[model samples]
Each structure stands twice: as C-alpha cells, then as structure tokens.
Target: MKKYIGILGLLTVAVIWGTGFVATAVALDNYTPFQILAIRFTVAFLILLGMNITKIKTISKKSFKRGSLLGVFLFLAFAFQTVGLQFTTPSKNAFLTAVNVIIVPFLGFLIFKKKVPIKGVVGSFVTLIGIALLSLTSSLGGINLGDMLTLVCAVFFALQIFVTDFFVDEEETWVLMLLQMGSAAALSWLTIFITGEGLPSIKMETVFPVLYLGIASTLIAYFLQTASQKYTTSSQAAVILSTEAFFGMLGSVLLLGEKVSINMLIGSIFIFIGILIVELDIPQFAKKQG
Candidate 1:
C-alpha cells in the first residue's frame, strides 16, 4: 500500500509539474528565470517552515547536510535548464532535460551502489524514446552550448532523485523537504546577484502565476516527491516521474489547444508502456533468465 501511495504521489508530482510549464510561462512575462525560481522556492520554503515549525529544533545535522546537497543539485538543474533555453530551442532543452530518465539508473549504480532492476532499465530507454518523439520535432541539430548545459541539467536532476531516495529513509521527511527547498531558494537569490539581474519587481499580473508555481509546483509537488520517494525505488520513481513530459503534452493539447500529431500519440503510448512495464514488474522473467 505504501508502494502504491508512492507511485500515485510521484504521478501527482508529474501532473503538477506539467502544469508548471504554463504557470512558468505566465510568470516569465514579469520576472527573469532566476528571479522566478527565487520567488517560487521562497514561497515553498516559507509554507513548509510554517507547517513544520515545531519540529524544526529536532532536525538532525545529517538531514541538513543531505538536504542542502540535494538542494544544490535541484538548483543546478533549474539554473542550467533555464540558461540553456537561451542558447537552444525549447524543444532541444526539453528533450535533453528529459534525459534524466536515462541518467538516474547509472547514477544510482555508481553513486549509491543501487542495482537497477532489468525492467526499470528497459523502461528508462523506452521512456527516452517516447520523450524524443514527443519533443524532437526537428532533425538532430548541431549540439550547442545550450544542449550541453541542458544535458548537465539532466544529470543534476537525476542526482536530485537519487539523493532524495538516499536520505528520505534516514531523516524526517518534512525537515528534508524544507531544507532542500530553502537551499534552492537561497541558491537562486545568489544566482540573481551573480548574474547582475538584481531582484525582479513583482506586478499584479505576476502574482497569480508566481503563487501557483510556488504553492502548487514547488510546495505541493516537491513535498509529494520527498514523501513518496521514501516508499519507491529511485529507478521506479524516475520512470514514473518521466510522465511529466506526457502530462505536459496533454496539457498543451487540452488547455492550450495545441495540435496533436501522430508522433505525439505514438510517443504517449510508448511512455504509458514504459510506466506499465515498471509498475507491473514485467522484468521478473528477464531477471530469472539472467
């Protein structure tokens, strides 16, 4: 039951993160990327802080260390992704960032010595193909600085998931969540200063989008991820969360009235199959054969 809950929670994170694209687009009209991230994470940290105030004193040093490390990965992922967007097309950035589905297993094996199940490994490739189909409308273009940056961003994201799985069982869930968010917020502000962007001035029009991103995407989605990763294998969690691409495409079609192509439908089908493969433990036979 906990496993099932974890699966559902990760899926929920995917859905909320999917909608975050829309909210982020709205917020971008008013704020720069670093500024937007700063506000979003700040709001999330504050809310979690308020809710977990009583437990704050009990948070262990290990939890702070792990959470802060995870926070750096999270911050780097977003920072590279947003910066990469300036140098590459959104399609390229999206596809490369989605490569986290591919990186998680290897990182898990190398960094944490976690053996990825055969089925999970297969599902990651399947998901990658689906993401390519969904995001790559153009031919493989020349690799640019943006593409490289986005690929690095994918590594950071994969690390974030693996590290979350690493620490979730050892620490208080809320404490980890709060510190991770707080660290990310702190990093974003630092980036804003380093980039000389200064702080962005918020307007009435920006409030709704920033609030949605803060509360829904950062706060709710991230907390769900932290709590849920406790019950699921990191590989399984990565595959499940890869559905964010599917959800994003779905939202575009449904809400933004974007036209869906045959490729899109086929890609979505493949993504579903990937998720199903992991969820159903279809690799048991493969393991037995090995």
Candidate 2:
C-alpha cells in the first residue's frame, strides 16, 4: 500500500507539473526567469517553514547539510533550463530535459554501485524515444548554445533524484524538504540581484500564476517527491516522473485548447508502455510462462 501511494504521489505531481508550463507562460509576461524562480521558491519556503515550525528543532546538522546539497543541485537544474531557453526553442529544451530519465539509472550505478534492473534500463530507453516523439516537433538546427546547456541541466536533474533517494532514508521528510526549499530560495534571491534584472511591478495576471506555482508546483510537488522516494527506487521513480512531459503535452491540449496531433497520441502510448516495463517483473513472468 505504501508503494502504491508512492506511485500515486509521483503521478499526481507529474500532472500538476504538467500544468506548470501554462502558469509559467502567464508569469513570464511580467517577470524574468530568475525573478519568477525567486518568487516561487521564496513563497514555497515560507509556506513550508510555517507549516513545520514546531518541528524545526528536530532537524540535525547532517540533515541540514544533505538538504542544502540537494538544493544546490536542484537550483542548478532549473537555472540551466531557464537560461537555456533564451537560446533554444521550448520543444528542444523539453526533449533535452526529459533526457534525465536516461541519465538517472546510470548515475545510480556509477555512484552507489547499485545495479540497475534490466527492465529499468530498457524502460528508460523506451521512454527516451517517446519524449523525442512528443517534444521534437520541429526540424533540427545543429546543436547550439542553449541545447548544450539544457543537456547539462539534465545531468543536474538526474543527480537531484539519486541524491534525494540517498538522503531521504537518513532524514525526516518534512525537515529535509524545508531545508531544500530554503536553500533554493536563498540561491535564487542571490541570482536575481547578480543578474541586474530588478523586480518588475506585479499585476493580477502575474499574481495568480506565481501563487499557483509556488504553492502547488514547488511546495506540494517537491514534498511529494521527497516522501515518495522513500517507497520507490530512484530509477523507477525517474520513469514515473518522466510522465510529466506527457502530462504537460496533455494539459496544453485540454486546458489551452491546443490541437492534438497523431504524434502526441503515439508518444503517449509509448510512454505508457515504458512505464509498464519498469513497474512489472517481465523476466519473472517469462519464467512462469516457461
């Protein structure tokens, strides 16, 4: 039951994150990427801090350090992705970002000496193809500056998942989450000043989107990611979370009334197959049949 809950939690986050593209679009009208991140993480940190104030005393030095480390990786991932967007199209960025699904299992093996299940290796490849179909809607321009940065962003994201899986077992979930949020917020605030993009005046359009992103996408989704990793392997979690891209595509079509294409339907089917491959014991089933 705990495992099921973990799977469901990841799926829920995937759905919410899928919708973030729209909210981000609205917010971008009023703020730069750094400014948006500053607002999002600051609001999320405050909310998490408020909700968990009574338990602050329980967080140890080691937990704080681990969470801060993870937060730095998280910040790098988002910062690279946002900056990469300045030079690349969103479709290319989306495809490259999803490449982290392929990176996660390899990082697990290389860092911890943990063996990735054969199914996981195969599923990651399958999911990579699906993401390509869904996100590569345009002709390829030779890999440019933004594409390279987005690829680096994928590595950072993959590290975040594996590192969170490593530390979650040793730390309390809520405390770790709060520390991570706080650290990311601090870094983002610093970047805002360094970049010389002063805060723009806020309007109602920006207010609602920033609020949703801070509360739902950052606080709730990240908390769920930390907690759910307790019950799921890092590679399995990566495969599940990769569905965020699929959900993002679906949300655009449904909520924004964007037209769905044949490629989108085909890509969704491929992703479903990839997820099933990771979640099921295919080799054991084959043995049973024999």
Candidate 3:
C-alpha cells in the first residue's frame, strides 16, 4: 500500500508538471520570463517557508550550504527553461527539456565513475531520434535558439539532479527544499530587476495560473518527489519522473490544441521505449550471459 501510494504521488507530480507547461504558456502571454518565474517561485517559497518555519530554524550550517548550492542549480535549470520559452513553443520546449533523461547517465558516469549500461546508450540514441522527429517541422530542419536554450536547460537539470542526489543523503529534505525554493525565488526577482522587467499588475486570469505553477507544480510536486524517493530507489524515481514528458505532451494536445503528428507520435513511442529499457535493467541480461 505504501508503495502504491508513492506511485500515486509521483504520478500526481507528473500530471501537475505536465499541466504546468500550459499554465506557463498562458502566463507568458502577459509576463516576461523572469517575472513569471519570480511570481511562481515567490509564492512557492512563501508557502514552503511557512510550512518549514520550525525546522528551518534548526537546520545546520552545512545543510544550509549544501541546500543553497542545490538552490543555485535549481535556479539555473528553471531560469534557462523560462527564458527558453520566450523563443519557443511550449511543446517544443517541454520535449527538449525532457532530454535530461539522456543526459543523466552520462552525468553519473563522469561524477561517480558509474558504468554506462548498454541499454542506457541505446536508450539515449532512441530518445535523441524521438527528439529530432518531435522538433523538426517542414520549415525547420535543425536546432533553433529555443532548442538550444532548452538543451542548456537540460544540462542544468542534469546537474540539479546530481546535486540533489548528493545533498539528499546529507540534509533534511524539507529544509533543503525550502532553501532551494527561496533561493530560486530570490534569483528570479533579481533577474527581473536587472533586466528591467518590472512586475506587471496581476490580472485575474494570471493569478490562478501563477498560483497553480507555484503551489501545485513547484511546491507540492517537489514535496511528493522528496517523499516518494524515501520509499523508492533513485533509478525508480527517475523512471517515474521521466513520465513528466508524456504528461506534458498529453496536456499540450488536450488543453493547448497542439498537434501531434504521426512522426511525433512515433518519436514519443521510441522515447518511452528507451526509458523503459534503461529503467527495467534490461542491460543486466547481457551481464548474466557474460
């Protein structure tokens, strides 16, 4: 039952993050990237701060330092993602950002001397093929500015994942999460000022979407992710979280009316299959024979 509950929580996180693509697109209609991120993270930070007030006071200095570093990585990940959206469609942005799944194994290899499994290599190839099909239009043949920004976002996200993995074992997770949220919010606001993007007066339409991004997508999803990880392996968590892309594609189609072509559908299938190969430990079959 506990395992099932954890799966439900993770699935909910994916769904919220998926819908967040649409919310972000709507919010972007009236706000700058920094302004939108600032609004979202600010609300999320405040909520987290309130919940962790007692624990926040008791966090060790070392934990604060590590959490702040994690926050910096998280800030970079979202900052690039938010800015990239200014130059790209939400569907394209989501798919490109999802490439972190391919990036993570390489990061693990470089940082921890972990062996890259054959299945992971094949999965990476398949995912890249899918990304190509998904991003290419009849008019555009290769990468564009938005795609480039999202690729950079994917790198930062990979770094964020690694950093979180390091710190999760060393610090209180909620305290770490609060610090990360606060730092992201602060950095986003600083960017807003530096870029001369003043906060526009909030409209009724903007209010709900921004709140949803902060509370539902950022805060609650993150909380669930942290909690779920306590009961599951890191690989399992990554596999579950990778479904964010699937949900993002579904939400885009249903809510934003984004078209999914036959090529795109084929690409998505390859991506999912690739992820399954990696997550299910299919490479272990080769090891058994050898």
Scored by CA lDDT, what does every candidate get?
Answer: 0.78, 0.78, 0.78
- lDDT at 90 for candidate 3? 74
Could you give candidate 1's per-residue lDDT for residues 32-137 as a string of tens digits? 8898889989999999999988888898788789889988999998888776656654434544565676677778578668777777677767867775665555
Model 1 segments more than 4 A misplaced: 85-96, 112-148, 260-280, 283-289
Q: Which candidate has the highest TM-score of all?
A: 3
lDDT of 1 at 3: 94
State residue 107's C-alpha deviation in candidate 2, in Å: 0.9
Alpha-carbon RMSD, each predicted model: 3.2, 3.4, 2.1
Q: Which residue pairs collide in model 1, if any?
A: none
Look at candidate 1 and tell me the lDDT of residue 66: 88
Model 2 C-alpha lDDT per residue in residues 173-242, reported as the tens digit of each score:
8888888889988899899788788875667855888889889989999999999999999877877787
**lDDT score for residue 148 of model 1:** 78
Of the pair 1 and 3, which is ahead by TM-score? Answer: 3
* RMSD versus native structure for model 2: 3.4
lDDT by residue (107-198, candidate 3, tens digit) is 78987889888878878888888877866666666566777888898888777665666666556668878888888888998887888878
Clash counts for all predictions: 0, 0, 0
